[model samples]
Target: MSTSFLLFFALAGSVVAQNFWFSFGDSYTQTGFLDNEALPSVANPFGNPPFPGFTATGGPNWIDFDTTTHNNSLVFTYNYAFGGATIDANLVAPFEPTVLSVTDQVNQFLQTVASKPASTPWTSENSLFSIWIGINDLGNSYFLSDNRTSFDTTLLDAEFALVQQLVSTHSSLFDVGARNFLFLNVPPTDRSPLMLAEPASAQAMLKANILDFNSQLVEFAENFKASNAGVTTLIWDSNTAFNTILDDPTAFGFIDAVSFGTGPGFFWINTLHTTSPANVFWAEGVADVLEGTIF
Candidate 1:
């Protein structure tokens, strides 16, 4: 091609490369799974890989979109998971009155969103948002704080309220007019190293609460669908799969002790992560769900 023609094509290509994928949650959805350039390897041991550090290759993460599909597409996914983040971490202005007593991460998300998110670049047509938060709301309340029953009672209401708030308030970005989205409800945070280290006696309660939380999530998705016909959004149940991993580490080629670790014959070596192969497994499932449910 002529130089002028090439230059014009290059400029046009850059314009089309602005599509985005936004992620909200903890390590389950962040660059934690992939080798994003910005992650801290020292604090996050599994950020790197072959399985113990950050990398340019996109670590083993579910939110890591298809590079081929996203190539020249400018697909930017945001990792809104704050380290040690939780639900209701900050319930005030720095944090908005969130649905769940979740955390600063959620508050920060609300903060970053424009009062008028319906603005230009934030248009829904050019973006896809994947939200996988909420487990921390219940998990932290139950495990870290030692108040399972009471938290569970209050949390479901909070989870429902949060979902409703997100769906109703963020209609512009989520519904996207004719465009739609995928909402990932709570992945199993209880399976993380923080909770897995608990005594076996605590395991049953931990697993049960996760199920209860996931049930509420499913209910919210279904309820939203029934109530709003115009919303094209759908739910991707990462919660089920993540729970599977936690319940039986060996299923996903993991051997967990205090955390997701590597030893003897296991592939997962980090406290809260799996190897590239495992990460790929989860990502494939997410891709399939998107393909089957959304677009």
Candidate 2:
């Protein structure tokens, strides 16, 4: 084999040997992979119900695409995202009480995977923990008559508090040797079909809140990295990605950017969620971030 081909195989082998991704978020990132269900294996990476699992996109969501399509390695994804999760149910309740919040998901991770059990042995160097929340937290509270700016502060405080808990040395993911983290900021939900139908002022308010949250999120991540030693952090700007596709749907193979349907032509599957094709683009973007091709 040529030198270039040999290098490719070497890198591929390293990736295939060890790559575990732990995902946490809401509807946008949910894949319905339960701990009680079947565990992830090489034969069936996603486990449980199948490749796509139960998703909001009407097909495979970003998690599925990331694992199967964008990944150059054999990645076993352990997803703990619920459909209507918020940062904290006490702060902003989910659509249902049973829906797991970010707090609950982290708790679940501690209870089940913190010990690095034999069934899923993952190391700090080989595993990645990703969290993509804040959409529901902001969406459910942005329209409240209460002081919106103060609410955003309160929400991020609670959200980052949980993040601190996760990285703390006592009984947490960091204690279990997980050092890599990828935090995805809230996407442009204000441009979704649901928000588009709202009054222009309402849409503008939501967009403002999103921008505020994303800016604060960046500051928090920078501070977090500064405080924590031996930890790697990455922030993916899903907002910009959403806007890029929405601005030019044709460039991304979508017939309509402002419509919702089950067909591939529509960017969204419902009033609030994007279609699988859109998520494919998201997965690709995430892959780029992971490969260090983009910041």
TM-score for all models, in order of appearance: 0.62, 0.90
Candidate of highest lDDT: 2
Of candidate 1, the 10-residue stretch with the lowest lDDT total is 1-10
Candidate 1 achieves a global lDDT of 0.48
The true-versus-predicted C-alpha distance at residue 30 of model 1, in Å, is 2.9
Best by TM-score: 2
Query: What range of 10 consecutive residues in model 2 has the weakest lDDT sum?
Result: 1-10
Model 1, position 289, has a per-residue lDDT of 66
User: How many Å off is the CA of 23 in candidate 1?
Assistant: 1.8
Give each model's clash number.
Answer: 21, 0
